[model samples]
Target chain A: MQGKTGSESWQEVWDKSVNGPRALIDCWQEIPCDPCQEACAQGSIVLSSGICAPPALHAETCNGCGKCVAICPGMAIFLVDRSIGSGLARVTVPYEMRDEIRLGGEAWAVDGEGNYLAEGRITRVSGAGRPGRTMLLTIEVPEEWALKVRGVRGRRKLLEEPEEVEAIEAVEDFAFCRCEEIDYSRLREIITQGEFRSLPALRRFSRAGLGYCQGRFCQSILRSQFLADCPEEDREVESFRVRAPVRPVKLSRLGGEDG
Target chain B: MAFNNFRILQHPVLGEKKNGKEVRIFLDGLPIHAVEGEPIAAALYAAGVRITRLSPHKKEPRGAFCMIGRCTECCMIVDGEPNVRTCRTMVRDGMRVETPRGWME
Candidate 1:
């Protein structure tokens, strides 16, 4: 792996002769979580330092059980089998992207940073006996690219295509009050430039809280902005005034016309 | 024609959406299809009905924000009731939804 952080490298594990298959614990961070250690039946996963230390794998004892791959909350564990066939390697990666890549489908293998490496065929997609959130994808890659490939590019372009709008321009145009159609710049002006010291005064001036929501949603946002610029002495000012009939009541019911 | 932009065909994590019973609802007198028990705002968004109501003072176009019921941006007239929170209200068959031009219906 290009971004391998732990002391032991994947190349060192591959050099050792294992019985069947072995897990490559890629977890570099010292985070507090240990479901992967407990999932292993052979006790191959060792957290020698403590709960927060990264797990170490005993490659000789690990039977490529894939228990750590499924139970790992971080989804950092992978199962690599170099003895699959001649010039072929099988790498089981934690897959949670979507239903885009299926069994026997062509998958574009990617590195840690999602850079395209090589195309691999999806040999298996397993989520059985594991939480529905995380799935395992087995891809047969070239033996040379086995250690380099980390994940498969699955449905990234289709889902994220619509959100390519310029973020800086979008922020200025983003509406703070959907009912009032008040954008961020307009709201900021109302809070900073407007002479309203209190939320009610600002609401009265801007007609922001008077919308159908009755200030339920935009009140907090307005308050934070107001407090951000307002002096410490004026911080105790009252927020938006709440009125009766909080829930929307029908006109007929309010008028008692429908008896 | 029904709008298809907001319709999630297949989600990466949740997989395919298992929508409830399909039902008909009216948006400004135009008949639209929606899943029963889903928020009216979701149906309207799926149909590409972005501007649900106009601001009372400036007539600014407004649509669903904070898909949760907290934001009244998605409010519209539902079944003769003014200021109904579409994001919170569930869709019912033959439900009448009207996007009033201004505050007064």
Candidate 2:
């Protein structure tokens, strides 16, 4: 949780006020994705730290087009126009939830962590793209809650807590690969029993990263596990071997011309 | 809306749900209304239909992880074909899909 949200310095970015609608990017995590930079046509959002870095918003130049709002795969970027009215502002938030709230529909405005702050009305819902990949729900809220509201929850969502996964007793039951249901105990036992030091070897024998995601998620965990097992000057962790048709493809597609 | 309906029928950004050329796909022999261009995984997700695949080793449940067709998690039997990535494959009118229960191995 330490590196989850922004630091104290980021408060300056969040509090940075503008005359019109400004793009607010809440993503502080160092994720290896940056579609938001390309999202802005006015060159408002800049990723000075290459592709993987958090965006640097040039709030002044932003036209509040809400293009970034729709294009952001993270659903993090939003537009806030403070110059709308006296003690009233319009905030554009990317909404992809279950409930159906229409334009001018009443919804509970929620904070960054989804706690309800106040009731707000959807002012402008922009379905901007050819078929917008993401829907931006613009809410007209009190000026005080303009910066506070990040999203809205329907009365149903407001009442429903996300389904929680209950805790089980054993660490052995901890599944390293949710796709394959390969547990830690099985992996550890296999590696220790066979003295398997290689990742590809362990993958073949234990079938940890062979499931869905094709080692995208579990390979890292297995690599870390291998690292934990060793007292070494250096550690060599070779990944799974690449093959033709690397992606999961149907056999029927292989027979087709365009496929 | 059904209590279990997770579909984004109307949203602020996307407006009233207009998925190109409305169609229906069969999932586990049940009719699921879907759009033509969108992948079956997305349609399933909107319908709150998770658990597309199950782990062959232990018979445990699995669902779509990466929406972009790279992962093997969302593989399902589509139109009598086995081991198809539902996340990548678009839903066709009357397309049939079912979880490959025992064949996960």
Candidate 3:
């Protein structure tokens, strides 16, 4: 299984930050959502390539603000501060469930995929009444596990130790960019050779987003897919260069009257 | 988790939503109830009519992915005009919508 897209930088920023708390967004897939970009008050998160692209978190600009946490419809944003103690980091996650949350109690920490990792010490809970209706829970966990732990579960569910298994590897041949006949497996194959770093190069190599829709349908998948495959640092968020005639038009319409 | 005829009645953030004015739209000569002011694609979805068009290359069913007008997957023959973006066009009373068998058609 491949690591999530655009997580390399999240890990980089997360591991080096001696500074106070900062927001770290776990959004990888390109769902048709972009509320997090509009929720940031510090202008740290931006969906540079419109709503189709995942929100890019500028970790340095973020002031550990929780504004983007509750605003996310996907519940993928998190705020972590390793500066709390010598070995403890405080991670705040957005909870939309109505389940009872006991403050100062221990809750089972889970990864992004809901697999129990370790028990997290609940420090505080707030946002009882907020505009977005999302409650934020501050859990203190080992500093090393802060970046991987995304959420905490209540004590109602028995602590069933998850069996060891490999993360599911997507093997379906479904193609999002049907116009170009590019599929996920094909994109992963291209990303592994270490050549697809730029947007135009990826497009030229794969021809996935250059179809009639011009990435209106496949840009999100392509962007997140690239980030997920190549977790290299310093990779700038990329989008396809604008090709005019945004909508499709017949060649006859572009040509001068039949001469 | 709540859905009525595939229409979201209330959302956590969007709150309660009441359909604007109900309008009549014909899809392939069949009467379909639709919400006025909403996109034609939305109305089609509410009516449980997906597969707006068959892709030109593979003849695969292509429906609305991005609700916005950017993606033309939901393009259909609307009011005698071909290749109309149903997601961008607002539903109008007595509108005729046709889902072409193939994009080339």
Best by DockQ: 1
- Score every model by TM-score: 0.76, 0.56, 0.45
TM-score of chain B of each: 0.90, 0.84, 0.85
TM-score of 2: 0.56
Query: What is the TM-score (0 to 1) of candidate 3?
Result: 0.45
2 against 3, candidate with superior lDDT: 3
What is the Å distance of residue A63 in model 1 from its true position?
Answer: 1.5
Which tens-of-lDDT digit does each residue in A39-62 have in candidate 2? 678877777666887777766566
**Candidate 2: fraction of native contacts reproduced:** 0.48
Our tally of clashes for model 2 stands at: 3
Docking quality band of candidate 2, CAPRI definitions? acceptable
Q: Evaluate model 2: give its lDDT.
A: 0.74
lDDT of each: 0.76, 0.74, 0.76
lDDT minimum window of 10 residues, candidate 2 chain A: A1-10
**Could you give candidate 1's per-residue lDDT for residues A1-259 as a string of tens digits?**
1222354756556754233456777888889988987888887777776789778777767788788898888878787778776777788888776447778988888788778777888888887333355788888888787676778775355334455665565334565665566667787787777777788888887776766677887788778777877766376789766777777666778898872
Rank by DockQ (best first): 1, 3, 2
Which run of 10 residues does model 3 chain B get worst, by summed lDDT?
B1-10
Q: Count clashing residue pairs in model 1.
A: 0
